[model samples]
Target: MNEYPIEYYQFFIKFNEGDYYTCHDLLEDMWMEDKSNLFLKGLLQMSVAIYHYSYGNVKGTRLMMKVAHEYLQPYRPKQWGLDLESVIAYIEHCISIIPDDIDKVSFSKIEELPALPTLFLYLEDD
Candidate 1:
């Protein structure tokens, strides 16, 4: 098994705490160090997408979710204790609910959207 860095775990902590912005910050440096690391890039994009959704920016949320999905698709099943398949499914679900005509949706209406379920990262042994 490959050992992951501290930031990798910290990203999950922030994510589960509903601190999506912090999740992005936790992984940004690692992603920067290895631009080819699709996992890290995908995680960063995922954090950004959730952050945008929290702020009721439907357009930004949809855009970021699409990019995150693209980066994460190749890692289906699992990677470094993360379940890419489940994550991708969740992203697709979020994308499906976002309206294509983004401009017409008010922030109040966006707030009414269902709250995303908490994401959990399981240990490899589990």
Candidate 2:
């Protein structure tokens, strides 16, 4: 397998562990090093979205999900051993569960919806 940065792999570890905040922090340095890396940006945004969803921040979740989708779309079927298609579909499903009018909804209401699944990132052997 091709080598990757420790942080890159750690991000997925944190994400799968339901530690989205840590996931975001783990990749911040890498994403900062390459501001133009859409993959990193997308993953960061996705982590933030899940973090917000976990806290029932309706508006934040919705906004972050939208941005993550836009940043990740170009990657399409796959990128860096990650399945972008499945990731995007998961984002779309998350967006669908969130109410359109954030003001009309309460955090408690959001808690009633199905919880977002843990996103496991499996690095493919090249």
Best model number under TM-score? 2
TM-scores, all models, native as reference = 0.87, 0.89
Candidate 1's clash total is: 0
Off by over 4 Å in 1: 103-110
Candidate 1 per-residue lDDT over residues 83-104, each given as its tens digit: 7888988888878877677633
Can you tell me which runs of candidate 2 are displaced by over 4 Å? 103-110
Q: What is the lDDT of candidate 2?
A: 0.83
Q: Ten-residue segment with the worst summed lDDT in candidate 1?
A: 117-126
Q: How big is the positional error of residue 107 in model 2, measured in Å on the Cα after superposition?
A: 6.1
lDDT of each: 0.81, 0.83
Whose lDDT is greatest here?
2
- For every model shown, the clashing-pair count is 0, 0
